[model samples]
Target: MALHNKIGVLGEEIAVRYLKKEGYYIVERNYRNKFGEIDIIAAKESYTIFVEVKSRSSENYIELAQSLYHKQLHNIRQAAIFYFSEKNIHLSSIRFDLIALKIDPDAKKIDKLKHFTNIIN
Candidate 1:
């Protein structure tokens, strides 16, 4: 895998662990369709969430990560809509989430992590 892809995979794994620890039950990962790809799909309480994970080696990950997929959020949303239409899921609510991570390239550990909830709106 390329360096950025490796970073993304590692960041996504970390995001999954963080979500589980935060009481979200993982429904799926890497859900892709004609629209786009959603890095993680999870459920918590009454919400089914579509999450996008972004990773960077720099400490300025907040803006960088957020900007990286700002435009692609639409594609993720489209995929989520397609997903809901095809699945039997009946969550009371739906959400779009973002998990941004700054990883230590050498240690492969997170230097910073932020989870933005309901980001589309």
Candidate 2:
């Protein structure tokens, strides 16, 4: 795999761990539809969350969360809609979330992570 892909995989792993720790039940990972991809799908007490994960080795140059562009958000929304419809789920509430992971190469650990909920407008 390419270095970038490896980094991305690491970031996703970190995001999943964080979500599980936060009491979110992971329903899916890399869920895909014709519209686009949702990195993670999780559920809590009253909401189902569609998550987008951005991971980077460092945040000094650019923050990982900043990479979620408008078009990407649109795609994620479309995909989420499709997922719900196909599953025949009438959710009380649905939300979009972004999980940004900052990896520290030297320490071989995640330096930081931020979860932004209700990210879609």
Candidate 3:
């Protein structure tokens, strides 16, 4: 894999570890549709979460933070809708989450990580 792809894989791994530690059951990873991609999908309580993860080693965290915008949000929502319909999942609630990560590539350590929940609704 390319360096950027490696960074994303590491980041997603970190995100999954954090979520599982926090009591969320992972439902899927790298869910894609015609709309967009959801990096992680998890279930907790009655909530089904669609997560978007932004990972980078060279870029500033703030810049990575700004990378997700309205278009992407819309696409994610559309994809989530498709997922629920396709999977026949009938959850009480649906939510969107953002997991931003900045890693030390050489050390394979995360320097900073933030999880923002209910990003869409």
Off by over 4 Å in 3: none
Which digits, one per residue and each the tens of the lDDT, describe model 1 over residues 29-76?
999889988899999998989998888997575575548555687788
Stronger candidate by TM-score (2 vs 3): 3
lDDT of each: 0.87, 0.85, 0.89
Candidate with the larger lDDT of 1 and 2: 1
- The TM-score measured for candidate 3 stands at 0.93
Clashes of 3: 0
Candidate 3 C-alpha RMSD relative to the actual structure: 1.3
Off by over 4 Å in 1: 68-70
- Cα shift from native, residue 92, model 3 (Å): 2.9
Predicted structure 3: lDDT? 0.89
Ordered from best to worst TM-score, the candidate numbers read 3, 2, 1
Give per-candidate clash totals. 0, 0, 0
Which candidate wins on TM-score? 3
> In candidate 3, where is summed lDDT lowest over 10 consecutive residues?
84-93
